[model samples]
Target chain A: MTINSKIQNINCCDHIARRVGDIAPSGIRKFFDLLASMDGVISLGIGEPDYPTPYHIREAAISSIENGYTMYTPNSGIPELRQELSKHLKNTYNLDYADSQILITVGVSEAMDLAARALVNPGDEVLIPDPCYVSYSPCVVLAGGVPVMIPTCEEERFEISAEKIEPLITEKTKALLIGYPANPTGTIMPREKLEEIVKLANQHGLIIISDEIYSRLVYDCEHTCIATLPGAYENTVFLGGFSKAYAMTGWRIGYAVGPASIIAAMTKIHQYTIMSVPTMSQVAAVEALRNGETSAAEMVADYNRRRLVMVKGLCDIGLSCFKPQGAFYAFPSIKNTGMTSEDFAHNLLMEEKVAVVPGNAFGRCGEGYVRCCYATSLKELYEALERMERFLKKRGASQAATFQV
Target chain B: MLNKILRLLEDDGRLTPEQIATMLGTETSQVKELITQAEKDGLILKYKAVVNWDKIAEEQVWAIIEVRVTPQMKAGFDAIAERIYKFPEARTVMLVSGTYDLAIIVTARNMHEVASFVTHRLAPIEGVQGTTTHFLLKRYKEDGVVLDDKNKGMRQKVVL
Candidate 1:
């Protein structure tokens, strides 16, 4: 058939699912497209670490392949990986999970999808913090569930308190989704505050999906796994991975741990959809868990240095930023410029060739800020800061002139 | 904190006290004071460059001389090692554990100078029994810094 006739015959829109069409495209993607067409742009828009996977971990993967481990693993993942993950969770958080309670995934991204799909029925509401990672709401939507956003503000250090979450709960609420050492803001939820939410969830008979992918990247504070809290283990699905810690993002490996029934439910969906994570990646992840601690600590130290430089530079440039205690981003408020986050990002990209993500890309409450990732080299970060300073000064001068007029 | 500052200075001696302070989030005076105290304590001896002189027009010969030395009563290899290290031509001297008792790095104006130093000076010592000299033709890396490919970009321009 001719191409036009074939397209017409398919009636693509009718065939497309309503839920898929309703999901909004990522707000960061358009800026990426513009950035691709431009030259000499210094971007602070990336969310992942700039470091390559630690050499030993990569070597482990290479040897795993050389030893002929290139087949699909069990639906629940390899036993050794699961055992290591169990040990890791126990050793790090003092939380115990048998291997049967853990399932390896293609990343926290897949684990999140499985959790949503297995738990949410049609119209069940999942309460999530506003200005969260871009995928949380979409995953809930795709699972035929409603995502109710609990708006958090900079005053609370962007933490979702129980007071804010309690009032939002209703009979239809099924789960609460949270990620700490959260993306875009780098705010970590304190342990006491997490316990408050856990209590609330228990009272309301709600599940909690805690994404701890950035758990190892925390600076100046300890990360609390919600599963370890009193009365939370059976109700919490703890999602973690080696991506941020081991610099293994491209490996696409993560795992989830919880009660056996919930994991089995998720695995039932996973068996048909994704059978297993890559065998080589799982072997690499095992090696990372076994011996990658030192390299991970070194990367965290480097990130801490860059974080100070970026945060201080942003504050010096007239954008007030909170001291992020974890993760690699510095979220600075741009409200003084009298421009929307999108316009600020666009104009800065156009004028000074420095790319930063508009904060609203994360959520509605992220309106007056922009997320600047500081995981790049110190030299590039300083250069980006200089360009941003120039852009801010120009905008400030123009705004002052408008006021005078 | 002081050890961290010392490590940064050790990695790159060119970093000023103010730069180190900014990087470490401490006062510049504190870094200066700690470094000065460390210098007085002899924790840091001296700062020197690891240069690849072959890149320049200047010619300097470098040789690694393995020396077999007879051990003294109490000093072991210390007496002979001190004698070899006393010469300015001997860049480095170490008591080794293998077939050689002392490994000495000697730099000179030419091969003749190195030969003279080995035969005339190094061999004449009472404890010095035998010697083997190996000339260094090129230096690919020194002091953990890659000498060649200085212009090669180590950091990617962009990454996620």
Candidate 2:
């Protein structure tokens, strides 16, 4: 059949479900698709680290498969994995939780979806910071909740202040979703900011969902958990994964820790839905959280080195960057270029073949800026900088004249 | 008198000679002379009312692309860079000093088109190194004023 005839026979209207409107394609995924076909493109757009999964972690997965441990794990997760996760939380963030408060998920992505479904009632409002993780809003919407975005500014290094968050609350505001070591912008909340939010949540009786997937990837400061703050442990649901620190994006393993009540609700939903994370992945993650400290240490050290280089490089190149307190990413202002974030990023890709995510992609506040992930090798990082310099020299005339070239 | 009229309209072209003379208390002949001089100096190219497209609802997709490239190639960085800029996906380009060399902006109907550009068009070019792609997770304000925050939360939410 001809293409037109095939199209005619298929009922496009019938195939499109109402949920499709509620669930739109991710903007980050869209850009990756564009980059797939283009030649000579250098990208700092994806949040995932470029490092290979550490050898020991890989071996653990291999060992699981070899030992015939490929069978399904417990609905909550393997006992050892949950225990390790529990221990890691107490050790790192001073946040205590029993294994029962944790549920191993396919990834933090799954944890986010499950949490939304478990907590959000239809039409309930979820207060997500503007320029948040791409997954949060969609997940909230899919769970039949409304996403109310709260704008954060660059002056605050994109860190949402509690004062800014307090007034948005209402009777219908069911939860507050916050991510630190933020993806598009490498901003992390200080203890003071978390304290304010914690207090406010307590006042309004709000649920606090913390996406701390980038916790171990922090460069400048230590990763602190809001759950550690007094009174927050019961209200906050902590989301974490082995992806950034262990460079295990493909492993698809993460866990959530929260109050026993919410944890029970999430586990019930998870049991009926995803069942459990892949057995090998759980094995790998357990190894990562427990025995993978050396690898995490080395990787974080390398990222810190690259982070310094990248932030300095962007500054030297005139894309002013605020010193990122945590995370191995830099969100640089592109305002001097006289172009929108999308325009700046597109031009950089087209002209210099260098790719960065536009600030606007994260939210309107991200306009006139772009995000650069320094989770790459020193060699790739420097070379990408050189190409960017040349491109900006030609495109950004005022800034170009200062270049030695 | 003619200067006052021009200043009021911000340009001589916006008003006919008769209108300007009536408004400024000047003769039509003098108004015409002032218009001719302003045009000769290249101060005014054309007079048109600026249209704010933001007011209209349009199906628009925006993306920020991170790109990597080899600075010094066998042929030179310019040729490879040129190839990247030539693609329709590129709307803006900049060379940055960081983990990646160049930052690009691209727009398309959907995610598939952006992906095609990366895999099919970009990665294969000579001297083209590596790339990590990030799609916009959310947007708060685009040009200047708040765009997405219909709810007033001074503190923004971002997940890196």
Model 2 over residues A256-348: C-alpha lDDT tens digits? 889888889999999998888899999999888878889888778657657766876777777778878677788888788788888777777
Q: Please state the Cα-based DockQ of model 1 relative to the true two-chain complex.
A: 0.29
**Which predicted model would earn the best DockQ?**
1
Residue runs of model 2 more than 4 Å from their true location after superposition: A1-10, A24-31, A397-405, B1-160
Q: lDDT for model 2, on a 0 to 1 scale?
A: 0.78
Give the runs in model 1 whose Cα sits over 4 Å from its true position.
Answer: A1-14, A37-41, A396-405, B22-25, B47-65, B72-75, B86-90, B105-126, B130-160
lDDT per model, in order?
Answer: 0.88, 0.78
TM-score, model 2 to reference: 0.68
Worst 10 residues of 1 chain B by lDDT: B151-160
Model 1 C-alpha lDDT per residue in residues B1-160, reported as the tens digit of each score = 9889878778778777876776788898999999999999998888877667877787789999999989999988888889889999998999889998899999999999999999999999998889999999988888767777665443333333
**lDDT: worst 10-residue window of model 2 chain A:** A396-405
